[model samples]
Target: MKDMIPVDRKMSTMQDSKISARGVQVYYGETHAIKDVSVEIADNTVTAFIGPSGCGKSTFLRCINRMNDTIDTARVMGDILIDGEDIYDPRVDPVQLRAKVGMVFQKPNPFPKSIYDNVAYGPKIHGLARNKADLDEIVEKSLRKAALWEEAKDRLDKPGTGLSGGQQQRLCIARAIATAPEVLLMDEPCSALDPIATAQVEELIDELRQSYSVVIVTHSMQQAARVSQKTAFFHLGNLVEYDDTDKIFTNPQDPRTESYISGRIG
Candidate 1:
């Protein structure tokens, strides 16, 4: 496995990180998914992970929130620190950790419950609000942040599954943000949407970066270029290069990154 890159060496000194990973690796049974990958995620910035299928971009993203822990056969090694605290420590609760680091999947998996219920689920579980009024406020704030409040406000009682694809995805985003997480993880969030829907989600992602650190895994280089400040390119379970999005797209130091960007190979 390749040596992990030091976070301070890779990121700008001016940037303050929300999460710092060091010597991270992940495996599913005997299959190695991520190989000694380390990088810093700056607060209030969007970091994009781009690579071909099976390159472990999504795998690394899932590692941040301990999502891989749900898989019985999965094993993770090394330290992942959130606010300089290691998340993998036995004392750390995965459930609580997930509340601080929310995730949205590639597909919009809205609950069968009402639109209001969908957004309220996270806060309800995390005990973020006590009274009904407080819960309502939390839900509304979350929906507004996700840019879905105006569209869904009147239909709060309606089933989340009844909404349009893009609306449903936004509802999911609202749900993730309801807990007021410090970081948000998105795994190919716009993959299933049409061009217009994709654009809307992309815009929402940009708006979200104002308050939370975001790490997105996308197969589309164009989308990565458009939404992310920092970009990491993975190839064959290796993080081949990580740098500013402009540099990664325009003048990457690694031949592998250059070849993938130029369409020679992925």
Candidate 2:
């Protein structure tokens, strides 16, 4: 059985965080999607957010990169700091912010352009490379980091959409990393992939944490256990519990977390 403990008690037990959220909330028109949630994402580690359908896990993830701003009715409040700087400040340009904090969605959305073009897009837009050779170097480096270079090195001119679902996802990851983002947000990245593809992506995610902070919203408890160093359990717009992944899976501190993880309730 899981213990019943206060949320603060659980958080106090973790190490320092790289990105911190305090009293964060989100609303879509009249619907309160997220309510007063606070948590920390450690640097160079993978953190997983798990919950049932409509539980605000994805909503909270979008807040980190300011993706919610694209929604007409979406509204976010409270503090979300990356490296101790409040991202919600009026001075923050979401365009520039998104460059520093990249996101990958549930589907493997690759552009219609060639694979090389896909990886070079961010660097081209951000002016990270000066000449053609520099841009090619950046693309090659990004693909190598994403582990897609061997498969894609010869097919650089092939359309990104021509790849398999799993390959496309990896390509998207390469595209995100091409910008050298400090943080990476993934929302159900494997939900659309097959078992083998899922495994490959999961392995890649683990490798990614050595250089970038990763936050993932996943529906599979086993996936979370396999990938994340930390886990946050959300229920009904509230963050019920957050702790080491091992503890959350083996011995959750909240009844709600226990119930959800134990298949008793969502």
Candidate 2 residue spans exceeding 4 A from truth: 1-15
Off by over 4 Å in 1: 1-14
Every candidate's lDDT: 0.89, 0.91
Tens digits of per-residue lDDT for model 2, 1-266: 22332223232234468899999999999999999999989988889999998999999999999999999999999999999999999999999999999999999999999999999999999999989999999999899888899999999999999999999999999999999999999999999999999989998998898788999999998888888888999999999999988799888888899889988886
Expressed as tens digits, the lDDT of each residue in 1-266 for candidate 1 is 01222223233343667899898889999999999998888988889999999999988998999999999999999899999999999999999999999999999999999999999999888888989999999999999988899999999999999999998888999999999999999999999898898989999998898888999999898888888889999999899999888778878999999999878887
How does model 2 score by TM-score? 0.94
Error of 1 at 254 (Å): 0.4
Instruction: Give TM per candidate.
Output: 0.94, 0.94
